[model samples]
Structures are given as C-alpha cells and as structure tokens.
Target: MAKKADKYFKEDKWKIIEEGFNPDYGMVSESIFSLANEYMGVRGYFEEGYSGNKLIGSYFNGIYERSEPDYNHYKGVADFTEYMVNSVDWLYTRIEIDNEQLDLYKSDFEKFYRELDMKTGILTREFVWKTAKGKRIAIKFERCLSMTEVERSTWQASIKALNFNGKIYVTTGLDFSNIHRNSGENMWNCGEKFIQADKNITLGIEGTTINTGLKVSSNCKIQADYESMEEIIEDKLVAVKLCINLEKNKEQKITKIIRNLTLKDESQKEEYEDKKAKIKDGRDDVIVLNEELKEESRKWWENVWKRSDITIDNDIENQQGIRFCIFQMYQTYNGAVKGTNIGAKGLTGEAYNGNAFWDTETYCLPFYLFNDREGAKNLLYFRYKTLDEARKRAEVLDCEGAFYPIATISGKECCNLWQHASLQLQASTAVAYGIWFYEKMYNDKAFIKNYGLEMLIEISRMLATRGDFDKDGKYGYYCVMGPDEFQMMVHNNCYTNYMGRFTLKYTIEKVKEMKEKYPKEYEKVVKKINFKESEMNKWKQIIKNMIIPYSDDTLIFEQHDGFFKLPHVDIDSIPISDFPLYNHWSYDRIYRNDMIKQPDVLMFMLLFNSDFTKEQLKANYEFYEPRCIHESSLSPSVHSILANQLGKEEEAYDFFGFATRMDLDNYNRNTNEGIHTTSIAAAWMNIVYGFGGLRSDGEILSLSPTIPKNWDGYSFKLTYNDEILEVKVNKEEVTIKTLGNKLIEIKVFDKVELINDEGYTYKFT
Candidate 1:
C-alpha cells in the first residue's frame, strides 16, 4: 500500500488515487469517491462483491421518509412527522466463476488500482483476481452518474480469461436488504414492495414509505447475453440474478443502466410517463450511451470551468484540492430545484439526517454568488419559499418574524438540541445576509424589488423582538449561541449583536428606499405584515444603542459578555486522545471552559473587515486562534482567509491545506458517515478570497493579491458586475486581466487603476 501523502497528488491533476484496497478503509473511500449529479448520487463501491464494512447509499434529493422523534423534554416538537431519510441502497453486484463467488475477501487480488476522475466525473477500478484452484481473471469496471441526464446512472464491466475460462457469471441487481444506518437499526424502514420483469429489462422494484406515502423505484436494464432469474431469499429480501458464459482467452463486457425515480412531487401518471419516455429514449448499447453521455458531461463541465477554474502553478496538490472542491460543490447542488436547500452531508450520506444547515448561506453562497448567479438566487428563493415556516418557528419560540432552522429538510427545524436549533439566531440573520450579499455581488436591484426586501423586513422584525436590556441597561441580545458552539448560552455574543444591528439598520434603509421609489409595493408589504411606524422607530433605537463588547487595553473585540472571565485553558494542556472535546466532555464542562471550537470574533472581522483596524484584526486573531480546536470542517477555511489578509503566510497555508483535504485525509474521522458538503465550498474561498485577495465594497472592486511562500504562481477567474476578471499572482508581482470588454476602475492594494474598453492588464511590482 502507498503512503497516504501519495494520494494527495499524482501527475494526473484530475484524478484522486487510491493505492491499495483495505477493508477497513473501504467505507471512507466510498465517501471520498462518491459521485452525484444534483438529483441522484451513488457510492463508489466495487461491482464485484466485497464482504467488508461498506455503506452502499444511493440518494435522491427532496425524497424522504417519516420517523417518530424521541423528544427529550422539548416543547412544541412534533410527535410523528416526515423528514429526509436514506432513500434506497442501489450499489449491488456479484460475479461468480464455476459457481465459486468472486468476493474480495474470498479471492486473492493483485495489481489493484482505483481512481475518481474529476474532469470526466467517472470512477474506475481494475484488479487481477485468482481463485483457490489457480484460476485467474482480470476485471475492469467504470461507473458514472450522468451529469447531462440527472436521473440515470451507468455502470460497465470488462472481464477477460487469463488461465481458464469455463463460465463467468455476473449477477447485478438492486438489494434493499442492507442499507446505511448510524445505529444498529435501520432508519428507512421501507414498506410495501413490488417488482416488474419483462424482455426489455431484468428486474424492477418499487416501494412506498410506511408513513410518508412517498414512493421510490429502482429499475435496471441489462445489455448482456445472460440467463435471468429472481429469488426471494429471506422474508422480504429480493434480488435478480443473470448468468453468462465466456470462451477461453476471450473478452466479454456488460453494461447495466440503472434508472431511479421518486414520486416526491409528481403524480403517478406523470411518473410512469416520464419513466416510459426515459426507458425508450436512450440507445440499447451501453457503450454508446456511455460515450454519448460522457461527451455531453464533458461539455457541461467545460462551460463551468471556463468561467471559474483556478490554477496554482507551484502546488499540484492544492490545485487538485481546489478543483475537487469545485467539482463536488457543483455536483451536490446546481440550483435546479427550488425550495430545496443543501444538506451538511449532501447526497453522499444520511448523517445529520440529510438536513440543511446555515453553512449554505454563510459559507457556501459566496461561491455561487461569484460564479453562478442563478444558483445563488435559487438558494435565496428557497428561503423565500420557506418564510412562513420560519415565521412559525419564531412564534414557537415566543418571538416575532422568522426564526430559521439550524438543520432542516423542508425548512422545519430538525435539530433536537436546544442550544443549536433555537438559540442560534444568527442563522436567520445569515439568510438575510445572503440576500444582501447577492445584491451586492451583481448590483441587481430587481432581487430586492421582488423577494430580498420582504425577507429582510421579517428577519429584522425577529431580531428586534428578540433583543432586550442587558446588565448594563443597554439593548442587546441575550442567551444566544454564536458561531463557536463551545461557548453556549452567553449574553451579548459579539457576532450575533453586530449582525443583528446590521440587519436592522440595513432593512430600515431599504424600507425607506422602497417607500420613496416603489410606494405601492412598500405599502402592500406594510399592510400584509401589519407594520406600524412605531416598530420602525424601535428598530432604529436598538440599532443605535446596541453594545459590542471590546477591550480597550488589548485593542480587540471580546467574543461575548464575560468571555474573559471564563476559566482560561490552553488547548495544548488537553491530551491527544481528548483532542475533540465534544465527544469526551459533558456539556457543563465544555460550556465553562475557555476553549474555542472555531473563530467567533475572527469570523465577525472577516465579514466586516473594513469595520476594524489592522491592529485590531491581528490582536483578536492572535488571542483566539491558539484556543481554537478547528473541530468543525467550516473552521479552517475562515482562519485561512484571515491569516492571508493578516500577512501570516505560513499559518494561511496550514489552515488552507487542512480544509482542502478534509475528506481525503478523514481528519475528523467521520468521512465514513458522509463528506462535509458545505466545507467543500471553503476550498474555493481560500483561493478567491485569500490568495486572490478579492473584496467588494459597494460598487468598487479591490484586490490585494499575495503569493504563498512556495514556488511559482496562482491565478483564478471571477465574475463581478457581470464582467469577468482574471487575477494572477506570482512571487515577484501581481497582475489583473479583464476577460470581458468593459471600462472600469478597481483598486490594486489601495491604488486605483483604470481598465479601458479593450481590457487592461494592471501589473503591480
């Protein structure tokens, strides 16, 4: 087996390499090599059977099941409701030779190789297998979830006889018997099952949920000369088997096209018609389907890369890491489905119960805002679609306006923890921030005129009602959880207060703008929400008097009220085994100890960097950084961007590397459960926001490009104000080029430069 470091980079920049097979790491590899196309995803498992620890997960977005919650003293929580559940298990196949099954554990394997090609979105594996009787056969397999057609998955296997060839049988079908579960028990609890078999296909299975009444179906079309058979192994376990014959020293190939469909939002007739059309639409030959779809998939990826690709000339590892992140981000969510937000685990796994988090708005939206404007708008549109639910959530909390969920599937709060779900008011603010962020990025006022303004107003109303007079007799928020979950139930959280204040002030400004420009719309909103002038005055009052805790002696903002008074403990004092305190410590112990889970004040500084001085940024970063454990996957990328701006190059690289390879390295030891979907976007942020040094202040765009202390250079393209600009930085100089024809002025490290209509190359030495 090759060392883990070797997998970071190879000569092929587009491929992720897995050197040798180990049963222990099989599930981890499944996550890192998972393939998805926004609608459906398939885990990267071997076509031939493997008796090992594996989670064979195939998921469809927005399709879910109902499960009863074990409420622990929480009021207003639902008794029995539907949430996102693991849909089905689709990756099932077995190869047999002379009735001797070819399993990984049972057979001797040599010369094994596995890789996931990011550019092509294909996973390939090849190995040589030898049976106990000295019979040898070489097998190669290729798999992909079609990017062009989001509902279909294609799998192909090629086998050749080396020593002896009597009969080679490949049994490929869908098995719902074994699926992924966090605990020992099954989560799906799949109900009624039905199968249909005919000449055009081998087998098809359709099932309905017990409580949700949601129907899921999996059908396989096999293109091979094989005998078809079906068996009901156990009480309800069913599988379809196909047996084939092979000549000596002759090569045989088979392709299995699997189509998965769900009746989540569609009627039964529409579903059947759509399935029938898809069944007859593609070619009968699997090789032709593979080539044709591969070409279309290549073109689709090319269009995105041309506008958003980045190149790190000095480091191949970082280059691969950045592309991997971008590829996965696009694969996970492409803004096709409205009112559907991304889960923390994406379609890759069932961890977090397939619930979305605030990470989508806070960490993931910026990537889409710059590269895919439509995608960014869809994310906000989802929030708008769920506004009523947010409002209901706020009412449940005895507050006004909307209170966004910490983790949710259909916009209802799914998190059971009180501190995380209810008290994290910043989530609602983050949704509002995303609206303002998208408008700022594109300078599009239509968004505000259409949907953004209403969202802001409701969120601001919630913030105003949630705040009260603190110990100092000043208006501020209390008993809130900030970005750092380590410090729970604290008063006057700096990030929450500042963001709340900003939300109030900004919404009031927009309200006035609407009243002046679009009076009818403004009046309609006011009438709908029953807004009174007195409430606006109260918002302004709170915004003016909101207190942000800061220490004058240290020239840095305190994370929250009385944060300095906690029992201060250095992270190094903890043992290595107790590294992640969440698993080892009780909530009471974790709350009082002065250990930071992630940046709190530093995150505030990064968002509103211009609000603070460089000295203050440095002081706050230095004070809070050593205490941080970076347990959350979202932590390192924020620190990386800050370190780059603060001229801490070494620290910047360390944090950047940690985030870019988070899943590949299995740093948190949770990749087996799922990949960190939201953190994947952070990799792009570390480049565009860190090394590229791109920042926007209203209508003015600025860059302060800095090269890491490595080798040659790095460059990336971004869309700003509907114009594309490519920023490249090297050891000695920085250069900016305009890809679109436009006259503009931008600041390069605080110096204004003019870019003419023909485009300009501004070089700073």
Candidate 2:
C-alpha cells in the first residue's frame, strides 16, 4: 500500500501489501469490525497519529439513516429523512499535549499494532506514543460491536504507566454542535452529540425542532475519570488536560484507584467511588470464571465465517478489497430501530444524517433474510411499528392508507425533494417483496398471518390510493417517478407499474389465505383497514391493464412513457470527481440525462424473477447496465446479481467490487459523514447471490455457480426453506451441504431443480 503523510488517506491502490499501525491516537490506532444477525463488517486505522484525520469506521445492520428529503410531500404522505437516527459516532477523541495536537504525523511514536482476531470479534489496539517533549506512554484499547444483547454498544480501554513523568491530565471531549441544515439538503454538518457523557456515559442528541440539540439526559451505565494539569503552550502555561505524567499514571493505578465518572442528565453527576466499589464486588469471581468476552466474539465470527466466508483468487488485493468493504458495514449497524442505519458516509464523516434508501428493500434485505430471520423481521417490524405514523403522514395530505417515508430517522418522512420522495414510494412494493422473501426462507407462517399479511394489505391499499384509473380502466400511477431520479411527473413507469401490480397480487393472495385460515382475523383486518371489496376489484383491473412501456424489439424497458423522447447522454468517459454530478447540475438537468441512481428494470426482474425469461433477463441486463450511473451506493450489488443471473461474469465481479469498496476506500469520497450501512448489505448479497449464485423461487432453493476468474472458491450458508444448506463453488461446479441426508432438489436457474445428495454439487454453466 502507498504511504501517507500527517494525513492518513487510505491508499487502496495496492491490495496485497500489509499496512502498519500507530497508537498514540487512543481510538485512532484501533481497527474495528462489527456484525449483527443483520450484516458483518471491519475497519483499520493508524493509532499513533494526533493529526491524521479524525478516525476510521465500519458498520452494518440495522444500520439506520434519515438520508435525504422527499420533495413531493404535496402529493403522498411522506418522503424520506423522517425515519432515521442521529446514531452515536463510536469514533472519538484526540488528546492534544501542550499546544501540539495529538497527531501521529506530528509526534514521535513506536510499538503500534492493531489486530482483529477474526475467529473472535475482539479488536485490540496497542502502541506507545510520545509528546514533542519526549514523554512516552503505553496503552491498549479493546472494542467490539455487540453480537449478544443485539443493538447495545460497548467498549473498554486499559491504560498503563510507562515512566515517572510530569503532572498528567486527560479530558474526554464530546462535541455536539452539528445537526441543522434547512437547505432542502441533508447536510450533516452538525455533530449532534447523542451519547450521554455527562457524569457517567450518558448523552442525548437529535436534530429536532431545535438547532440539532443533543440533550444527553439519559444513559445505561458508564464511568470515567481524569485529572487536570498546567501545561506550557506557545510559551505560556495554561491549565488544561490532554497529557499527564507517567508517575501519575502509575500513582492512579497503585495508591488510590482512579475515580470513575457517573453519568446522568446534564444537571446530574455520578457517585463514582461508591459505584466503583459495587462494580468491584464480583470482579474476583469474574476473574476466576475466565470470562471469554473476547473469545465469544471470536466464536461468533467463526460461525459467520463458516456460513459466509469467501475466498478470492490469488489476487489478495481483491480479497482485501472485499474484506475492506465488509468491515465498514459491520461497524455502523446500531441494532435498534430507534437508530436508522448509517449512510455511505459510515461515521467516518457525517453526510446524510437520516435517510433510508431503497437499498433496505432491494439490496440489504436478502442477506438478512437468509441468515438472521429475526433481525430481518425486526427491520420489517420497524416499518410496521411506524405504520400509524405512516398513516398520519397520509392524513396530512388528505389521503388514505399509510404512506411510508422516502428518507427518515423517526419512521417519518424527512426528504423534501418531491421527485426523490414520490419516486421512492415504490420501495414499499419491494418491502412487500421482502416479506415474501422472509416467508420463502423461513416458513414462519404465524409471523405472516399476523404482521406480514396486515402489512401487505395496508401497502397494497396505499398503492391503490396512490394510483389513478384512465378512461379505458387501466391503472396509471401518474405524476410519479421511478428509482431513476430522472423523468419527473411522468406517467406509469414500467418498474413502478409492475411493482404496483405485484403488490396488488401479493396483497390479495395474503388476504385470501387469511380469509380461509383465519376468517375472523381476515374480517377484522379488512374492517380495520377500511378496505372496501370494490377496492380489490379495482386493483385487479389495474393489475390486468397497467401499461408497462418496454420495447422488446428495441430491447429496452422505457423508464416511463416518453422517456426515450427526452435527451439521452451516456456517461461514457466522465471524470471521477464529476461522478457526483448533483453538486454541479440542477436536479432538472440530472433528470434529463440517461443517468439512473439505482436499478429499475433490474429491480423488477430480480423481484419478479419468474415473470421474466432467461432472454429477457439477458436483454434487460445488457440494456440497463451501460445506462446505469449507479449514483446510489445501493445500485452496484443488485446489478451484480442480475448480471450474474444473465451470465455477465465480468460485469458482475466488477460491480460487486465497486459496491464492496463504496465506503471503506471512500471510493465515493464522502465518508466524512457516516458510512452507508444499509447499502453495503448489497455488497454482501453481491458475493452470496451473484458469485455464489443463490436465489429463491418462493418454494425452493436455487443455485447457479459462476466463480470470478479471480476467486479460488466461494461458499455461503443459507437457511433455505427452513433447511440450512451450504452452497460451495470452485471454478466450475457448485456444491451444497445440508442436514438429514435428504435428497435436496435445487435449481441451476429458477427453471431447473436438480436432486443432489446430502452434499449437492452442480457444474458451472
């Protein structure tokens, strides 16, 4: 890897080389990786730097966001940005000795190593850093993104004394000044210190009706301590803390135990000594029991590896590339719905504060459904819990049915861009598809009869309300947009039209099943939804006649009617910096270009896989891949899967790499905000579904193996149709391992199912 100066810009150019570490930087020197049932990920950093950039980060699900605004609020209930969390930024604190900022680039340091034991989820950072005056110190810090009490955050630091030095002081800083931007853009300039660090580790921060206030009036349990010192800076001695004597470090460790800060509301303080004594009670017992917190983290990861590990070809660079992508995503996942997943900015920087993209439905969902059914259900439940608020959103516009947000942190609409928000309502259809995805994988019938069926009913009702009928009785979801931010105020978009029809079909089926199985429940649900039987008839008519303007002869699915009539400009040779054209061009201009933010035709094809034939998949893949600008970090992964299905091997791998590297290498160059947590699950899907050739037919497991020329072998485990099946692939054939020794019938594509022994294998196509 290329070396950097005082500034640490990850030179992701070379992939095979190992990078060194620097620890003077507290959390700075730490490398982290995180996983939840939702997703897995990691991160690396130089620990000794005081001046190297602030920190490195990674995150995974249910990584939250209130990303952008839904501008067309004048129409439906919500847009986006409403359902998000100003998530706690785990990356923190730089100690400035005297006037010199604590920077690895600015100081002399040694003995730095950041090790991530993949077997366990323990990340340990160790190093010694010296001040400009030659005061040396040794330190070790450990951290883990929780896998146990899902959604909780935890970390611990252990500092050691190295030498007899001067008076030492340390001040934990919690900056909470950024969270207000009303520029019709979600500019995450405000830090919004949400963690409570008052007396103990308690803080509250949010961009509410105020200037992005952080009211840290609450906490779980935390303790901290520090002493102040007078240090000379710029030829003047001032009382401040950021440095201390080796003697003081030793004294605190020996003589009197260091005081622990108790947390509380801004008005409260912790009773440290008393609590410390209480905390120490079982310490001896814990020491004897041999706590395996670190070991358990490893074991958990070992299980993940057994299920999800991938082996790339000798191109260690690409191997590193894929790992790096997974790393960033794993960290940012705040397991609670109270927290929205991070955006592409992945806590490395604050970009979109609270925006949920279609990535959640189309990209991130598959990964979660396959491995952690409950986690995926939690995400669905999140939307369900917000159903009331979603309804309120519709009422605000005098509309019926719950209209979910486009981008949000509070499960409320936040995005104010009309085209952006209305275009995303289409995601609700995908959300329905996600419900179906869960059912196919887990067969959790009770879950569906209760939450799933109801959710589908409401969403279908929402789509019905959102649509219009032409004189010929064909349904037209008019004046709306598709994933392509271009083409505003257009007629029925093929993707949108198909999605609506799909929603109607699924909702009716679910309602019908409920009616037969639980007549009372179905009647109660229908009554509660205020759904008229006439509405069902309307939906059927719409599904039967909805216009999808695709040209088979031209081999193209028009994004919407009159789409080709608009000016067409391909991004054949655009500069990297120019890739984010929204900064320069007007939204109108952007809409006019052939550029698309994410998959539209590909999305339809992926969701309704059985609807499109092999030739259709090939045709759409070829037509849309070139035209796709992939502005959304959520795009590449879906494209990769479709490409894989269509036998476009090279495009699949390249797009997969692009998706995986989106935030880690900061390929989008926007990691300054928070990472794109939800979007990255797409990268995982690209590996499992695209490379491993994993798919579903709602009733059976399907596999079509096509290893990248660069991969040695790749394998992934899935709980398919309630059967835990392992799919392994080399250069040609694919193998599956399952329990019970049943002859499993699998499909090469969605069309053919092959019966293989307990361990199934199929040659590459």
Candidate 3:
C-alpha cells in the first residue's frame, strides 16, 4: 500500500499511450522500449545527439554468433555464445549550445524531469536552463512510436524556451562507439562505419560500413536540427524536418525524424527516392507492413490476455505497472535462436552490455511458456540451432557433447572466465533447464519428439559428459562453480546436482524415445558421440540418486556440500553505500557472509517450479529473503514472486516494487550506466509467475494469484493449448476468459480447473 503514496512509476498494466513534445532522449528509449513481438524487436533509439548512457541495441531473432575469431578456445566449433555487434546508432550526436556543451547535469538548471508514457506510447523530457548570459529557458522534448519498421524505429524531440529567451545552438550527429565490454570481459572491437555523413542537409546523413557492409540486415537514417520560426526540410534517403517556434515567455519546439530503409535494396539514391514516391502514392511499400505491425502488437497482447491470469485490481497505477512489466517482457523475446534470449535489461537499458545469461532459463522462459508457449518453444529451438556449436565448444575443451556459452550476443561462448566466466556450468544448464521448462510447459509428444526432445538430448548430453561422477556409491555431478561467486572452485553444488538430475532424466528419456522412434537420429548421435548403452545406465544411476546437501539444523538448503563450513553474516547489517560490495568486499568476505547476488537454491526451485513442495518453497523463500543482498540486478524480482506465492505479501511487494522501480528510482544507484534489462524482465516474471501465478508444467496450466495490496486489480491473457484465455485478478476475486477457440483447462489457485470459458470469475488465491 505504501506504493500508492510513492512517487515513482505507478503503472500496473501495459497500455499504449499517445503524447506530444516527447523529449528525444526518453522518446528514443520509449520507442526502443515500445517494442513488439512477431519473431523480432529493437527498442527505437535516437541515431544522433547527447543522449545519456544510450546503448541502442537492435537484435534479430536467432541471427547472432560471430565465427570469425572464436572467443572460446574452440576454433570454428560452431559457437553459439557470440552476440555480434551489428548496427549503427544514429541517436547520439554531441550537443554544444553556443560552443558550451549543454551537459544537462552540469548546468545552472532549475527544473528537469523525464517521462516515458507507455499509454499511447510517447517519451518526454523537460529542463529549465539559465544560459551563459543569465537568461532562463525551458526545454520540452517528444518522440513518436514507429510500428512502421519492425526492426528499424523512429524518434523525435522538441526544445523550448521559457521566461527569458535567447538564441541557443543544438547539434545532432550519430555516435558509433556505444559498445562496451559486457561483464567487463574481453575488449570488443568497435566495428567500422562504411556510411559517412558531413552536414549535407539535402541528402540527410548517410554512410556505409567499411568492413561490416552487409552484416547488418537493415539500414536507417535519423536526423534532427534545431527549429527556428519555420520548418526546415532535408531530402535524400528519408525525409527529415525540424520545426521550431518561439512563444512569448514560453518555449521552443524541435522534432527529429527517423526513417528506416531496407538493406536489401542497395539501389542508387535516385532509386530510393523513386521508391519513397511510390510509397507516398500507395505502391508496394513498408506502410502496409507497418499496419500489420500494429495489428501484431495488439493481436499479440490480445492473444496473451486470453489465458494468462491477472491478479492486480483497479488501482490503475499498479495495474499499469503489471501490464508494463509483462509488455516489456514480451518485447524482449526474439525466439529464433537459443542464444538470442532476453538481456538483463530486456531491451530496456543498454547496461550489462545487453548480454544473455542464466536469467533466460532461470527466470524468463517460464513466463513465456505459459503465456506465450510458441515463443517458449522457439527459445528451445535457439538452443538446438546452436547445438553444433555446443558440441564444438566441447571439442575445443577436448570433451564430448555441448558446452554452451556463459554470456553472449552471438551464440559462441564469448564469456571469458571472470565474473560468471567461472560459472560456465550454470550457463550449460541454462540450455538444459530451458529444455526442462519446455517439457514442463508442454508435454506435447509430437513437439517434444519432433523438436524439443533432440535439443534436450543434446544439452543433456553436454551435462552428462561435462559432469564428473564421484567415487562414493552416491553419485555427484562435479567441476561446477555454484551461484555463490565468492565461493569458487566448488564441488557438489546442490543447484548443479539438481540440474544434473533434471538433465539426466530428460536426456535419457529423450534419447531413448529417439532410439525407438527416430532410429536414424538416434544412430547418428550415438555414432557422433561414440556413446555406449552403458552411458544411459550411468545417467539413470546418477539422476535417480544425486546427493543434495540438506541442513536439518537450519531447516534450509545448503548452497552445496561444505557450505556450513563457511561463516555467516547478517546481510541486513551491511550499509547501502557498500552496495555492489561484490567488487569492494574481498572474495573471502563474501564467502564468509550470508549474502548472495542472486538465487541459488531458490532459482532451482522457481525454474523447476513443480519439483519443490510448497513448504520447501516457503521455507526457502523466508530464509533467503532476509539474507539476500540482491546485489545482482536479476535478484529481487525472483524473490518477490516467490514471496507472493508463499503468502509473504509484504516482502513480495517490496521486492516487486524494487524490481519495477530499480532504474526509475535509481534504487541500486546504477541507472546512470543504463537500465538493467535482465532485472527488468525478472521484474516482469516476478509478476506473472509470482503474483499472477501462471505456470505450465507440460500439461496443466496453473495459476496462484496474489495481488500486492498497492495494486487495485490486474488482468492478462495467455494462449494455452491453442486456446486464448484472459484472467483478471484483484484483492478479492479473479476472472478468466477465452478469446480463442478451443476446449482447454487451466488450474486456478493451483486447485480449480476452468474449461472453455467465454469468461469466468472465481475467488482469488
């Protein structure tokens, strides 16, 4: 309920809002953030100017992996761990007002604020400035949403002068080197720009990459110039115009235009102009595709509302928060490749250098599986697409089976052994867990056998080969660094042990099915791996009885064996200033403390949702919530969701809000770098799986709704078993609806199952 009085992002549902005078900086993000799903997406970003901490990452579904110089020791082993740096960011141009850089932070400014309105979809930024001559001015900016180009996007900004007015200068140009080292790993090479531009107004700005000419699939032209009393127009590949007007004691308005062009058409300038004319005249053009894009966005969400449960009620602000969370998550999924999973920031922020991690398997995919099962299925396909690379990764390591990349923009294992570079085993299970989630969400024998089963088998193969068994009759999977980064060189991690159990079960089952059904695939894989029948026996033995450390003394799960030998410190005693102590505290300090950057056992419990008993889930949630430092951007939301499910309402609210408001409130004080996309997606999952309680376990779609007190009511849709259903939930009751044709059943509160509902209402969990 405190969230109601809090001055922060107060939306509980996702709505497309329309607005004007949206500042370019926020608009670029809003537009980029105003992403959609139809197999691809990119947050619309400004191609020019002083946008703070902007990393405009545009990614294609399943189109990653740089095979050139293998980052992993493996040579041309079909690495799926590489996330290639692909396009040009036209949104970053330096701003020098009167030759004095108008660095907003360093100015004698009175008023400054920014807003990203998802309702109607617009971005706005406002600021008051006292010029060098002591003249006061106000600036308001806005940008438009582009459903026009699915991959390409557009943005615009308006500047104004209020009170004392004076002539001001604004500069717009593209910033090319926004790429930073992800996870502070390898030094990434800033690819060259073949296209060059030099203050040529008539032609706008244009250039080609020096080396990466065709690497990028799309080309875009974005331009902005200060508006005077009239409109200034420039024509070349795209139309760009700046409109500025001065009001008496008010402000000035400036707008930027971004035009997306097709890379397939490498036509001459005249050809592009002719195409533009035809488009204007209603010829074969992108405008039609644009229309479909809008339908896709609407239809996508509409279909989503069909089966997903909604738990928050009337408090529109909280309602907006929930929808916005889910909407953002939907925007992040690209579905074509396994390596092409959502980022830490989920396309919302450029921070974390926009790399994929355990977050995808551990947090994201489950939400997608129940609500958007097709998308979830595609996530598995992504892993399968990279299976060759996984195997090649093994070859490079002189091992059998696949070893997926820890962090990558492309599918290759680009992560060096540093931060989580050491948690390579977690990355391996990411694919393995994804396979498990798929099976849990959809027990479709055809889907599993025809598609998922193979990928599962391959990934399971990776674990079987990668995991070393101990001598004791009780089997243990080894050589894995657990979630506790401080406690390195670990063995018998409970999480890894569980993953091996899951892998072995699925791998053995899938492999056996293939051997019976698709003998050729079974024979080929067997020949390729030189796998013996005894291997299946080994997997069965290990899976049936893997040793997991239990602490009857504490009634909590140990991170792994020998974890009790480590010291314990109260996480709450730590000060906020020492946030991100992972870098400040000695590894020993962390190892000795009862703090964690993210979930270890809890992660396993959530990902393998049905595996743990409710009491176990509750116990883990209570014990870990207190000690969790949430230093990792991906932490709070997960705990929030779990807490909500366990009736830890207050804890759930805090964590959920923390996840939602992280960047907006600067909760972690790290927003200056960029928003945490991975955490943002986790925040959404915390809502869907935690509060909305939507989980599909191979057959039954289940719901356990619990709205935070601050939220009035929330509603969402899900596409389950080809049926479209919508669920609305509030403090008191929940509603369900079927938007698509199909007779299907869904478990409400993990108890009642609803069948073929045109719409149905039931008591809330």
Indicate which candidate wins on TM-score: 1
Better of 1 and 3 by TM-score: 1
What would the TM-scores of all predictions be?
0.92, 0.77, 0.75
Per-residue lDDT of candidate 1, residues 1-765 (tens digit):
011232432334678987768777888888888888878776776656677777767777877765666755566443444455555556577888766888786689898888888777878888888877788888888887777566677778888878775777676666655543753344444443434455544445665555666666666666666565544333223455656666667778777777776776554658555664544544333333556766777788888788888888867777777788888898888876656778788888878878888879888998888888888898888898888989998898888988888877777777767778877887898988888788778767777877778888889888989889666658888888999999888998999999998888889888988889988888888888887767888898898789889888998788898998888887776776775667788758878877888878888788777778889989998888888877777888888898899999998987887566777777677788888988888888888888788776434777888888784988898877777777777777776777878766888787788764454454545
In model 3, where is the ten-residue run with the lowest total lDDT?
229-238
Cα displacement (Å) at residue 84, model 3? 5.8
Stretches of candidate 2 off by over 4 Å are 1-106, 115-118, 150-292, 323-349, 573-577, 739-744, 749-757
Q: Among all windows of ten consecutive residues in candidate 1, which has the lowest summed lDDT?
A: 1-10
Q: lDDT tens string, model 2, 1-765?
A: 011113332333222121455333233223223233223232344322245554333333333333334344455534444322232233333455455555566666678655555445555566676776766666665555445433233445445556545544443322222222223333223222223223333332222222232222111233335553332211111112234444535533211111112221233334323333333332212211113444555566666656555556565544555555544444444243322443434443334543555566666666667665655777677677667877776666455777776665456666676566655566577678778777766767777866787778778778877888888777777887787765678788888888788778878888778889888777777777776767788778778888888787976778787766766676666665565777867656877666666777787787767667788788777777777787776777788888887777887777776565554455554544445666667777778777776667545666766778876776666765555677677776776777445555667655555443456556655
How many backbone collisions does model 1 have?
A: 0
**Candidate 1 Cα outliers beyond 4 Å, as residue runs:** 1-11, 70-72, 76-83, 183-199, 227-239, 266-288, 470-473, 756-765
Candidate 3 per-residue lDDT over residues 11-78, each given as its tens digit: 43454332332333343334334443423444544333334544455433433333234455434233
